[model samples]
Target chain A: MAGIPKPKLNAGQRKSQRGTEEAPFVKWLLITVALLFSLVFLLLPLVNVFAQAFAKGFTVYWDALKHPDTIAAMKLTLLVTVICMPLNVLFGLAAAWAITKFEFRGKSLLVTLIDLPFSVSPVVAGLMFVVLFGLQGYFGEWLADREIRIIFAVPGIVLATLFVTFPFVARELIPIMQAAGSDQEQSALTLGANGWQTFWYVTLPSVKMGLLYGTILCIARCVGEFGAVSVVSGHITGKTDTVPLHVEKLYNEYQGAAAFAVASILALGALLTLGLKTWLEWREAKLETLAQQAEQAITQ
Target chain B: MSIELKNITKQFGGVSAVNDVSFTVADGQLVALLGPSGCGKTTVLRMISGLEMPTAGEILVRGKRVNDVPVQKRNIGFVFQGYALFKSMSVADNIAFGLLIKKWAKADRDARVAELIELLGLKDLAKRFPHQLSGGQRQRVALARALAPKPDVLLLDEPFAAVDAKIRQELREMLVNLHHELNVTTIFVTHDQEEAMEVSNRIVVFDKGRLAQIGTPREVYEEPASEFVARFIGVMNVLDCEVREGVARCGELEFPTHGVADGQRLRIGFRPYAVQVSNDLMAYRHFAVLRHTYFLGVLLRLELEFPSGLIIRARMSKEEYARLNLTEGRKISLQIRQYRVLAREGELLPPEVSVTHHLGPSPGDGI
Candidate 1:
């Protein structure tokens, strides 16, 4: 009877507060429309990828994944990610440190240049690399004389992936580093720590979580890059072919299940990356709440 | 002098943030750089700490010119306003960062950390991260960390600006006690006049990127060097008046001037504490109705409006208010005991030019 009476009271109270609330009909309509939109555009595509991958059987899917070409593509993609992650992290840390901690001429221009990869088309990036490193392009004769093969090789794929994923880590880190400020670094310096020591102990640790989050995003982008890598890879079967290029080649040759199987691996990787990002965000929020609680404790 | 800034000037792209400001901190003495926001007090503190290089000047620590010395080699302690404790580090670790960098023995470093932790009353918070501590607690941690290295000089930039009012008072007392106990040369920047006065042995006031006055708390308060210092340090009633014959008149208030040209405009200022009030209308030479009463704990600040519509603020104790039975709109007699002839902005006036006006018979009516 108490529970029943509570609902009745709540109903009256809600009706009294109806001025601030949306109409029930409009609310439900919007919710339903959003759910339907996600189901059609997001859920269906994801489900279709898995379904097509396993349409024949698990054996066919397993066989496709075990193919030498697919194995080569996986290894190549992993290699590229391993090579690109450290370089991008280094670049991101340097760029963020410089932009946030100092005043210099053309700082804004440097920031805009760091974001150039994000705005420019990946195809254009790959084409620029080819023009620079190809046999008929600038520095081509010099490179030929040294017997250096860059475009249409594993190095080309790595370069393409690097260019396409350049901004991910830096973009993630800039706002965090900016908000954290240089006070800690100054404190470190005043505490008898030199520049490199201060950065290693103070600045780097302060932005560790943000750097990790950014690195994850950068890795995800590096793993999935297609357009630029495609232009520079030259479709070399076991040498230059990345995961995406291999998937494209399999599909073009009517190996639909094989292609979808490889695509599912990428799709699964993206889902895992999303999960990691969400977890990082949750941890960051929890840390903030702890800080807020500390403040509240002080006020109390 | 433990720290001496000689003709220090810092310019950001030709816009000077700190002008040719020079000051010295005696060894083991506490000093404050006090001013309003954007007045370049913090810039002076930063230059001393070697955080910012002065475009033109020499910084000497213990009589050594340190303009070319890097911050790390300077061996100074600096506390930022935000208490920039490393977020990832525990309280103990943050305090020991400098010691570790200096390569102190593990046992000695631990002893120093424990000593600072106990000294700062952070016994139970040794393992707690920066985010897990309160603002006041974080401020103490920052102070302890700065003090851990036992540097020659300690510089703080607006140290208590981030804490609540009540906690700010506690931190001020803690800093004063710490400086006394350690006997370290300390210079802190603050815009709060009361905080500066309450803590430091001497205060250096700034106005528009230039040093205004540097003196003991009493000297700076009682004998302000300029009109800016007079108004900025505390509440002062300022009036612009023209000299007529031998008297300077603004409204109903008049001050006798000596050797001044007639019709010469002058700015004058007096503190509210200088205005004496009495309940009886005939007790003083002038009378006015009380306009407003502002309660400031033990003291009451009353606004007295003259018959000519000139209002002046007078401060008295609450006990005196009760004794006089003073209320808003009550008629009261008031007298300004002293006032200073002020110089215009950017003009220098000797602080000793304060004029004393005694209550005597004048040509005007006693009413």
Candidate 2:
């Protein structure tokens, strides 16, 4: 048996119908374009830095690592990260708990203020700290007379880095905490658990993975923070220089090999961060799978 | 273990969720708070568990007031409707949670956890997380977790509502057995009437934020106190009727009634199974066949049309069907075997007033 003839299409009809047939190809083209852009902007820079670092063989890289100024910069960066990461994590947890677990006026306003650092430029963030603690700024004379220097010092660098990194942990933690509903806490309360006990036992365990992931991100950002720390540290060669500040100074002073050497360390740190991120993402995926399974089991 | 709720009322905003409700649950007895959604049965359970506080009233547990006492100090255990198991913990660890919070010794806590694992049939799944367990297994784990600490009182809010039908039946039986074995003052909340009837020794029916009735399940089902209770407990057919000389007159028929004055209009109700259907044409019973017949596995339900054009359901067993050879479109005579009269509007009456009257066959006599 023969089939019926298909409907005919006009020019306008064919033009309008073209998109649906080419939709998949269009999507693939868009993704490929984005991937190529990211490769040019991101991966190429890291590969260039590695190539530059190894241009004069490993001797120059080893000599740069042995340099006292480079050692001091690395130590300062490590110290700031170790000190600031935990503080940010703690404050982030407190802020998230306050925003999610309690009902108060101006909650949305407070949350916006917590997210202010993300929108603020790092240089402007450093300038704000300078305006607050510089020689002519508020509390400047008192701190200066007391020999407790803040601006143009390590303290200023740490402060600016901390200001820039504050929102990283909190921003990551807030949504995770919000998605875990209040049922478990209420259950704990009804089962004779006090407020502290409920939070410690029920609430903490549920958000532990998210909290750890956010803390790791905060540490990574604090260690790699450049523009803000540069403006505040004054780039004193062996006194207040962080890794990024030292790299900038070396690059400007015709020390291209040394700059790439230092840049390679930051690249390695970024790689470690990528690994941590992957681990955390795997954990999140596992949690989601388990949740879906639980839902299916309940329905069944 | 006696719990007294004195004029307890809870309001959200200006709307009352539980309004001026008062009842006592005796020690070691299981009471089911039965109602439809938004009727405040779950709210009442929550208030009693201290998850929610009443807007006005006092709660006394074992003769001492506990309205101001925190949940932890009150020593109550709650099994939520969703189970709410800690996903991070294994079944054994979940059951050991309350004991650990109480600072029980490690050895003692482990022993208690082991005991509950065996008692709840979770020994095989002891090391498995909640996400790894089946629905029935999860429910058993929740029950074990709630009961591990030997709480002074137990509260369950629709604990079996999330399970499948077959599992719900099994869980209901297990709940009844656990209640008896533990002898803890327990209050179970559910909207399913069959669940309440099966699991509770006494049932407290609520309607629109108020207590409708509190009685044994048998009494509530067999001798409901009001129209609402009668209609809610089981399948009751209500019809408009007039009382004359202690008898109800309905659509060319008169049946014996009690406590209804003459010339008074009232609503009358009877259970579907209480109706007697017969195929004998010589019988002088007062009924007409309506349009449809519903065949339930063990019983056949017939929809009867009276001369007043009112439809009523009459339930006949399989044996009765075989005896009468009943089928669709067949004319069958129905006799009102038992019924109750309810008061109409503007009549000064008790909150729950019903006049039960049985005509024709005596109790336990079948057609």
Runs in model 1 with CA error above 4 Å?
A1-12, A15-22, A290-298, B279-283, B322-330, B344-367
Worst 10 residues of 2 chain B by lDDT: B358-367
Using DockQ as the measure, the top candidate is 1
Give the CAPRI class of candidate 2: acceptable
Q: How close is every model to the real structure, measured as TM-score?
A: 0.90, 0.88
lDDT digits (tens) for residues A1-98 of candidate 2? 35988779889787675544767678799999999999999999989999998778899998987899999999999999988998898899899989
> Which pairs of residues clash in candidate 2, taking residues 3 or more apart in a chain or in different chains?
A192-B72
**Candidate No. with top TM-score:** 1
Separate DockQ for every predicted complex: 0.70, 0.44
TM-score of chain B of 1: 0.93
The parts of candidate 2 lying over 4 Å away from their true place are A1-24, A141-147, A283-300, B240-265, B346-367
Position B233, candidate 1: lDDT: 78
Instruction: State iRMS for model 1.
Output: 1.6
